[model samples]
Target: MKRNDCILAAAIFLFAGLLSVMFFLSGNEQGNYVTVTVDKKVYGTYPLDETQDIEILTEFGHNNLHVENGTVCMTEADCPDGYCKRQGEISTEKETIVCLPHKLVVEIQGAKPNGGRTEEQTDGQTGEDYDILVK
Candidate 1:
């Protein structure tokens, strides 16, 4: 191709590549919110939809919780006090929501996709074994 034509083509290619990169980077950001509670009280809110690890230690013991795609679950905790870990995984709008001493926990299942409206149907509930997650 002629010199001018070659330069024009290269510029177009560069712009397209740059646009692709920008779109990719912007799309990588997830925007879901989750509220965490400790001992029946609200503690904090954090980005909910992503695979990440958080360690919490209460007056009782320490435990590791995993947050992924708006779902939070216990992965590990101090074996001596297995309260948190034993609670198991929670992924519903109404969740476990508490930690006794280390004073940390979040059990919530709001609309999926962060803000999708839920049907709001319920049989009316509350039982230990019927929890959102079971160990």
Candidate 2:
């Protein structure tokens, strides 16, 4: 309605835009590793610092996971929707790519957990132990 009001509105919009940009670029920076899981079970753990291609095959289907330039992504998947491949890339702790149809999950962990744990230390069980309880 007035020149001063217009300038004030413009400044507020610009400030808001800059804040959003900063927040988007300041994502978590601690995690340097990725973990792959299928049907809630640990399939493999990979380092984000390395470049590699990982092929995962199971009764449900096949998925190709790729690690490069400190990022991890699902490069291919046989699931009907192929959503896993479209999840883009992840490099921060707690980030994940999920293939619901194949029951697959890829997550970023800040560090390897306790150099891994023994079966006994993990209550003498793993996800496999719950298979019979599922159905």
For each candidate, how many residue pairs have backbone atoms clashing (under 3 Å)? Answer: 5, 0
Give the total clashing residue pairs for model 2: 0
Instruction: Write the residue-wise lDDT of candidate 2 on 91-126 in tens digits.
Output: 887677878788787877776645446312222233
Instruction: Please list the Cα RMSD from the true structure of every candidate, rounded to 1 decimal place.
Output: 7.8, 12.1
Candidate number with greatest TM-score: 2
Give the top-scoring candidate (lDDT): 2
Against the reference, the lDDT scores of all candidates come to: 0.58, 0.76
Task: For candidate 1, give the lDDT.
Answer: 0.58
Model 2 stretches astray by more than 4 angstroms? 1-31, 115-135
Worst 10 residues of 1 by lDDT: 115-124
